[model samples]
Target chain A: MKKKENKIITDDIMIEVEKISMRFNLGIEKGFSLKQGFINLFNIKKRKELKAKRKKNVFWALKNVSFKVNRGEVVGFIGANGAGKSTLLKVVAGVMKPTEGNVDVYGNICPMIELGAGFDPQLTARENIYLNGAVMGYSKNLIDLKFEEIVEFSELREFLDVPVQNFSSGMVARLAFSIATIVDPEILIVDEILSVGDIAFQAKSEKKMMNMIGGGTTVLYVSHSLAAIKKICTKVIWLEKGKIKMVGGTEVCDKYLKYMEGK
Target chain B: MINNLKYVYAKYSFLLKQLVERDFKVKYKRSILGIFWSLLYPVLMMAVMAIVFSNVFKFSTPGVSYLTYLLIGLTYFSYFSEASNLAMSSVVANFSLINKVYMPKYIFPLSKCIFVGINFLLTLIPLYIIIIATGTGLNWAHLFLPYSFICLFLFTVGMGFILSTIAVFIRDMFYIYGIIITIWTYLTPIMYDIKIISNSTLQFLMKLNPLYQIINFARSIILYHNVPTLGQWAGCGVSGLVIFIIGIIVFKKNQDKFIYYV
Candidate 1:
């Protein structure tokens, strides 16, 4: 009965995650040499030792995670570090496929997953804008259309030719935020972008996000700030150690907050 | 596969351009010589080889000047090594983007090929000037330049894709590839002549190396001043296509798994 509904999408379902799981194999690595590698491959006792190590290497980053994202909904993901927020986000973005189950997204997704995700520090601010825009899936013509607006918003008029490596951290953050938000993609996946730069810039960035939401774009956001999540997100998914502990409205936030206080 | 390709290209074609440009910019930054180094490098190597091979060993070119003969080989071999080495590291080097961003993994290796191809372009004018300077007459066979280049370019990009994928799984690939490329360079008869080899079996093995086939293919047009035989043309196309097709399939299969490893 449940298997029958797995593939179908009714109205208002923009993204659907069904029992997605991710497993990471982690291990200690000795320094690499061809001779050492070949020896490790053949040694019987060493093979058994390696097998034991492999057992210890298994890390379940996400386990049986299921959710649904409706159209034009701003869903917030709140979790502690290593709670699989980014992992789950990557699976939904189709950057990484899940080990089990699947995610169905019915919209064009533009992920601002990490600030300056494709920027070369050695390249100038102007260069990075074009590069980042391309990474955001904007064509060269589209970038040309929005290049001046990005520069104006960044307010680095004097430093257009200066390499981004030389820019201040806050200044770099401004440039990154400006490029990510310049064009509103259909389904925006934002990860902690609002916490960057100075206070005024944060406010300005929040306002830009509000404008995108107003334009009927769906968003899946990951952030550590509960107050900010409550202010912007209509629904919240609280992840705890690779599991969806609770899912609801601000009540989920209240329960998550209470649980955090208890912990 | 066609639909998938169209989607990725439509989405990230501009990103691919910026990435290639970024590589060149980073490569030449803070260097006084800048891109002249691209031209200077092969020429300087040829000069050193001419002294040792021509003056010391007195190696012979059958009809063409030894300078032009060695320069063509050096130019092509350098392009092969540079493109492969950069591409081998393409996936691992872009670890930050692989995990954080959503661009296709193939773009990483493809960008390396594009970057090296740009540097290869800098080698041509100097090559043409030398060909004219050494009294090597330009012929209609030179029209095959674009054909030879496309074959070589496909071959390099294919190798890059395969190497970058393997490097993701095995860290030792970094060292293993160096040894492999060195052995490959020596076996290809780049600095030495094919006529010097006496063993038919060893000679046959040398012919199997695609770079050997590609270099001679270019040399046929440039120095030999003749169009390649249909058989030679088929050899270049088949080898390049087979390698490129295999590379794309392997890369696509493992691309999703890469996020975990990278």
Candidate 2:
């Protein structure tokens, strides 16, 4: 209901990230344990530094980044490693709350951040489908309705009864992709899941994504694959070191490609 | 609050069911007698403890057979220990899934408690069997046993919420709680009588333990064949509710930060 209230005011905006900033504590290794904490307690200089305003261990992963995506717009995030693309995606998907500012998303998000994240390896593939479906917020009856479609799409009919622990990585990826895309999500956040499985399965998954996109599912995509970005994205945001460096169409991606090539 | 509960139940009940089923299945996957272990574990533990306490330690039971008293207390206490221990790590165990998706983080602990609670309910069958075997025949008062079980269930869930939240930040709690539960078990008078404690202050402090009150409620109904006094019911209810509310408050306040730490 909290997510629905704002949709009434800005119906067209599928996602509105307002000056969102996310900070991660790099001090996890410093005093995380009780032993380390006790040791640090007596170290006066270290304690004073911890109390100081400019703490060295705080790393801002995203800084005052603002953007809005209208309904059906496929917005791509292009960035080098550690450039805050995944953190921003997580914030928009409502997985991680921003340290400052707000992210207002109008619809349910299917985040393909790491596929098969919910799969219990000890369980059979058949069981994992329902378990993963429920984790994805699907009801039992809904999953039952689409169970066959998922099995057929994954091409794992012969291996459904086998535990996921025995599954080849490609088969697991196929099943994860099929279950994730079974229902057309209201908003889809894809973080580097396009490279799933073998080449044939990759093409199949891309076609499935295109079908979802054609049905007006707003997408936030992040990938290092520039060609894939140019193929699917209507607009692109280039990130550099936790800040947005550029925002535009495929032309920005071309510029990014040239920039990377020069480097 | 009622409306909020209803909303959560409607939205996430299916997920909770799936999680419980997953836990149940994964726990019993390779075992021959899957759920029978729930029934057998308590009975087996009671057999071991009943001999040691009654023979070696010579603990006396005034009204009921020592077997019945020990089994009742052991059954209820096992649920608390098992449920709380599992619930403590529920959040940390599911970190991989939580890192990817947006979920009400409280569900992980809640699901763990419910799963262990189901196993606890199964253990009651053996408790009743032992009671009947010991000639403490079933009585109408035994119908009121659920009152304490529900209270204990709520108390355990609240403890679980608080523990699970702490576990997200401080990984040491898992090991620390093991020792705490062992010390708490001895302090609860599960295997021995409270009469052995000669000091009135010590006895009063022991009575203040919530597990003692809940277990006493069960003992009154099952062993004594009498309804617990109104004061006893009030005490048990307040302890359960107070702890449950505190757990929820702590869990809610800290849940948003779990993603960062987890």
Top candidate, metric TM-score: 2
**A24-86 per-residue lDDT for model 1 (tens digits):** 877634334567679988898987787787678878889999999888889999888899999
In model 2, how large is the Cα lDDT of residue B48?
Answer: 96
DockQ of candidate model 2: 0.80
- The TM-score obtained by model 1 is 0.92
Reference-based TM-score, model 2: 0.96
Q: Alpha carbon lDDT of residue B24, candidate 2?
A: 97
Model 1 score (lDDT): 0.84
Candidate 2 structure lDDT:
0.89
TM-score of every model?
0.92, 0.96
> Where is model 2 chain B poorest over a 10-residue stretch in terms of lDDT?
B141-150
Off by over 4 Å in 1: A1-10, A28-50, B1-7
TM-score of chain B of 2: 0.98
DockQ of structure 1 = 0.66
> Per-residue lDDT of A173-220 in model 2, one digit per residue for the tens?
999999988877889899988888999988999898889877888999
Q: RMSD of model 2, in Å?
A: 2.1
